[model samples]
Target: MLLRLGSLLFALPALILLVLYGVEMSAVSDCTQLGGIYNFDTAECGTEAIPQTSYYLRHSGLVNGMMLLSVLGALAMSIGMLIKGMAQQAKS
Candidate 1:
């Protein structure tokens, strides 16, 4: 149980980060649709304006990759705990 809990505790942050990356992707893909402010005034109203490329997205990809690695590590730790628990049970 403790192993499962620990795995979940570590996994939670990675999951959150993954979700955040999805949101950031969505925002960057559709900035104007999401009510982003436009600097230039155009004759045609409601025209979608492109958002400037931000370094945040690039850094976010790196963060997402790290989070994925963390998730894998958590899974490995959980499996190790299970094995340890079984060995202890068998010894007793």
Candidate 2:
């Protein structure tokens, strides 16, 4: 029960984050398709390119780090649960 709860805790956040990330990516793609620059910090699409790099691109390390951590955390917890079940089966 504890393992299941732990897995849900990690998995839920990761799932929500992945959906949000996908939405952001889609917006960026739409902006690019329309020949506009999308500013992550400002959350604006503009015809004139900004001198500063994109908020998302500039802070890519941080963003990617978060996504990686959350996803990996969920995966690790799930794998642990699976292993525990397999071990129990093996014992029987």
Candidate 3:
């Protein structure tokens, strides 16, 4: 019960963030307004374009990738915990 509850808590936040990231990516590509600095004349949030520096490009990708990984990891952990809890209960 405890594991399932904890997994749910973690999974919910991860799923929310993943959905947010997806929305941001889609908005960026669609060139649609995202309010604030993410509006026109910008690539996306936490991103900038530099003439000579590659950091801008790399940083954007890295940030997105990290978020994706976190979401995946959280999902995996949640599933693992739920399975383990079920297995333990079955043995008793």
Candidate 4:
């Protein structure tokens, strides 16, 4: 029982991050639809933009970081859960 809870605790953060990143991706896609570019300084979309490629580039970095963390959490949860199951089976 404790192991189950521990595994779930490790997994919960990954689920939360996945949802947050999904929303962020949606917002970026919406911004791209306006036929304008996003300004990292103003955090808004505009025409005749100043080529703020850094906005997307920095965000991509953040997304990549988040993805990496989430994957680690998932792997931890998988291993923890697997160990818990085996321990229980051994006891039975």
Candidates 1 and 3: which is better by TM-score?
Answer: 1
The all-Cα superposition gives candidate 2 an RMSD in Å to the true structure of 4.5
lDDT of 2 by residue, 10-67 (tens): 6666576677778878998999999999877777788877675654676677666666
Tens digit of per-residue lDDT, candidate 3, span 1-92: 54555556555655765676576568665543543234333444433433332333535665566556666666667777778888999999
TM-score list, all predictions: 0.42, 0.55, 0.39, 0.49
The TM-score between candidate 3 and the true structure equals 0.39
TM-score for candidate 1, please give it: 0.42
TM-score-best of 1 and 4: 4
lDDT of 1 at 20: 67
Arrange candidates by lDDT, descending.
2, 4, 1, 3
lDDT of 1 at 53: 47
The C-alpha RMSD of each candidate to the native structure, in angstroms, is 6.9, 4.5, 7.6, 4.4
Worst 10 residues of 1 by lDDT: 37-46
Error of 3 at 76 (Å): 0.4
Ranking by TM-score: 2, 4, 1, 3
Of the candidates numbered 1 and 3, which has the greater lDDT value? 1
Worst 10 residues of 3 by lDDT: 47-56
lDDT of 2 at 52: 59
Query: After superposition, which runs of candidate 3 have C-alpha atoms over 4 Å from their true positions?
Result: 1-58
- Candidate 4 weakest ten by summed lDDT: 49-58
- Identify the runs in model 2 with alpha carbons over 4 angstroms from their true place: 51-92
Better of 2 and 4 by TM-score: 2
Candidate 1 Cα errors over 4 Å, as ranges:
32-92
